[model samples]
Each structure stands twice: as structure tokens, then as C-alpha cells.
Target: MKIDIAELIIVEGKDDVSALKRAVNADIIITNGLGLTKERLKEIETIAKDRGVIVFTDPDYPGSKIRNILKGRIPNCKHAYLNKSEAINPKTGKYGVEYAKPEAIVRALKNAKATVQDGSENYTLTDLVCWRLAGADSQKRREALCNHLRIGQANAKGLLNKLNAYQIPRAEIECFLAEYERGER
Candidate 1:
């Protein structure tokens, strides 16, 4: 199906933009994950405020971070985490949705939801960040967070917000893993 360009803002890399252009007619923007400039952010913010901004980032850490950054900046930006399952070479785990077929993109958007937030819980940011970086089972991650932080699900979410606000270092992800593992016993 052909998607119209008038209402959606497609956020992706240049190649993804190219693929998206080929797949459907959409207003697309490219961000190389170096973060957006204030001017660009403003333009995007303005467009997003008035229309729909669909964040179509690569399914990886940097891409995930870009989505997170945009969530904080864009007022009405909706995010679509491209399913790696849709890529032609799905097992390679590479970047860019350029390799994904048009059907995959469409399916992803159809199922896309509004931004997922940590909400107004009392948990620390560290807990949330750790949970994300752990690459463990969700039940395991939540259990670990609860066990280590001694906080309920409500507070665990707040911890995630706090961590995001503080800008946790990527290098320190290991520290969180260590702490979380230690707390398991």
C-alpha cells in the first residue's frame, strides 16, 4: 500500500529514507545518531507539534537512544521500533531498515503505539537503564530491579526517568549489570 507523505514525518538514516521513498511517498528526515541540531530539532518539533512524527530508527542501541532523545524533545512524536524480524538478513542484526521490505515497514507502522514512558513512578533512572541494557528476560529484569532497588514497579519506572535525566554513561552499563547480578543472590 502507498502511504501519503503529507501527514507523517519519517525519521531514519539517509539510506532508510531512500528505501522509504521507494516504498511509499512520505516526508522523511535523516539523523545519523550524532543527535539533532537545535535548528533541526526545532523544525522537527514544529512539524511534530502540528502533524504526526513517526520515529523509524534502526533496531539497535544507537537507534534506540535516538528514539529516546526524540521522545524528550518532540511534543507529539510517535515511535516505531523497526522489527528486526522483518529484515531480509534478519539474523545479521545490522542497522538501517533499508534492507526491510515495504510490507515490514507497513506492518510496523500499523502496530506502532504512542511513546512508552517510565511514567511518574518513584524508581531511579539507574534501575530502568539497567533493565534495558541487561538484555535479559523481562520478568528477570523486573525481578532483578525489584530485588536490587527494593522498589515496586511504580518506583522502578521513576528510577528509569531519573537515570535518563542524569544521562547515564554507556561505559557504566557494565557496572549496572554487575550490581544487578550481585543482587540476584
Candidate 2:
């Protein structure tokens, strides 16, 4: 028996469709990677108005880009965050929702969060820079932080927005950074 998801799940490709189908029952729409066109977004918006949407793309740059587009336009779509660690294909060494385990996919869907602008900027650009979450040599740190926060990987600006939009406190980021620096994370 599979889990029943009420929202329309959006993913990157057919492999993602196959993978998610193995995990749950839901209406799915494939964007074919970074190919989410205006027409497609319109279609998705129409469906989302009826059943809502869970944007569950791969845990990579392109995936993040796609999710961002949908978020900007749809405004209310739920987002699933599959850590890159769990989404990597062992043999191919590529990252995608298709590569993630069924359990991981289900877990991500179950924990999906809505990205909303609550007008709370808990952290700033300077904060990310001082915390080594931005600027040179910050990519890996950002990736690890996103994985820890289960908010998916993002570039500098996107990371800052997520840190604020998710309503994660400044103290939490500070503690996480300290733990990370101490190798106790």
C-alpha cells in the first residue's frame, strides 16, 4: 500500500514520476527539467487552484531554479526538500529526485513546507557573510546548512531568503554554525 497525497506533486522528469509513483499516490506533473514554460505554468496554476501543488523537484541548482519560478508565480505551492545526500544516485553519482529512495521521497513530501514572505528578515547579508554562508568558499557550507535545515540547497540570495522566510531564528543559525565549526553537527 502507498501513501495518499492530496496535492499535485510537481517534479523534473519521467524518472521522477516513476520514483514518486513508487512512493505514493498523487496527481503528478512533469516539468522536464528546466523546461517549465509559460503555458505549463498556466496549466499548473489552474490545477493548483483546485488541488494545490507540492513542488518536489531534484535537490540541485536547476531544481532549485524551477522551484523558485513556481514559487514566485504560484505563491502558495508547498515545497519538498530532498537533501542532496539522499538524492544522489550511487552508480551514476548524479543528483535527482529519481535517484532518491522511495522512503526519502515520501518523507520529503510528508514534511513539505510552504515558502511564504512573512516579512521577517531574521538574518541579513552581512550575517551570512560573517557566518561563512556566503562569499568565497561558501558553497559547501551553504549546501550542508540547507541539508541540516532540510530546506534544500540554495545560492546565496536564495539561502538568505529561505533563512528569513522559513522563520528560522538567528540563534538557531548561530548554534548550527558553531556546531558545524566544532565538527559536532
Candidate 3:
């Protein structure tokens, strides 16, 4: 399926550009991994202000770091999330958007979430613990929450920051936790 996206997608590398080309017809900017310079960021800012941006980084630490940086610089940027499982290259055991199937890419792009710039503190670390997103044996739950919320996986603190940064309401989180409990039970 071909998607016509008006905003330019910001990815980590050329491989990601290639993968996205197969899934949709849209303009893309390559950040060359964590090597994003101020000049490049300026260019990205220009494009983001003019046409908007969708950040589609890899599902790894570096990817999260890059996404955070972009979010800090460009508020209200859209985010496309692909699960780590979907991004794993079967042959190399590496993870990246380039390794994901075109269909998965299409799905992620279609469901991209826009950042909510509203300064609402809707959650705390205690909420993360209560939701099984922190403490021992929480990795699985954290991953599940990330997938459900489409926010990408992160450690407890990072998850809390993302939850607030995206302005996810406490009620929504409660619903997800309730559903997760039901599924686990």
C-alpha cells in the first residue's frame, strides 16, 4: 500500500530511507545515527517548521536518545513506533526500521502519534511501579505497555518522562493496566 505523507520523515540512516521508500512515497531526512550536528538540526528545524516531521528512529538506545533530542528541539513532532520484534533482521539479529517489513512500516506510519505539548503532569514513578512498569521482573510489562501505548520501550524513569511528555492521561494508563492485568490473569 502506498501512503501519501505531507510531512517529511526523519530517520537514522540511508538504509531507513530505502526501507521507507518501499512502504510509502514521502520525503525523508537522514540523521546518520547519533551524529546529528547543529547544522543538521537547523535544517531539520526548517523542514519541521515548514512541512512538519515524523520521527522514525530505530528501536534501540541510540534511537531513543535521538528521538528525545528531536523532541526537545522540535515540539509537536509526530512519532512512528515499530516494536523491536518487528524491527529485528532475521539474518543478522540486528534491530532497525530497515529490517522491518513494509507492511509493518506502513502500520507504524499510519498510527503515528503526535506529541502533546500541554504541560500536564499526569503520572509519577509510583504509577510506573503500580502498573508493573518498574521494579524486578518489569521488563516484560514495560515492553507490553510501550507496545500498547506506541511510545517505545524504556526504563522506568524514561517511561515516566515519555508518559508525561506525550501527555497521556492517568485514566488511559489505568485502562491499559487493567487490560494488561486481565490478559495476564
TM-score of each: 0.54, 0.60, 0.60
- Please tell me which predicted candidate would have the highest lDDT against the true structure: 3
- lDDT, residue 102, candidate 2: 88
Clashing pairs in 3: none
Q: How high a TM-score does candidate 2 get?
A: 0.60
- C-alpha root-mean-square deviation, each candidate: 16.9, 17.8, 17.6
Please report, in order, the local distance difference test score of every candidate based on alpha carbons. Answer: 0.61, 0.83, 0.84
Q: 1-185, model 3: which lDDT tens digit per residue?
A: 46656667999999999999998767788999999999999988876765589999999999999999999999879999999999998889999999999999888987884332233356888878877789999998888888887777899999987776455667877887788888951
The pairs that clash in candidate 2 are none
Candidate 2, superposed: residue stretches over 4 Å from native: 113-185
lDDT of 1 at 100: 77
The 10-residue segment of model 2 with minimum total lDDT is 113-122
Q: Assess candidate 1 and give its TM-score to the true structure.
A: 0.54
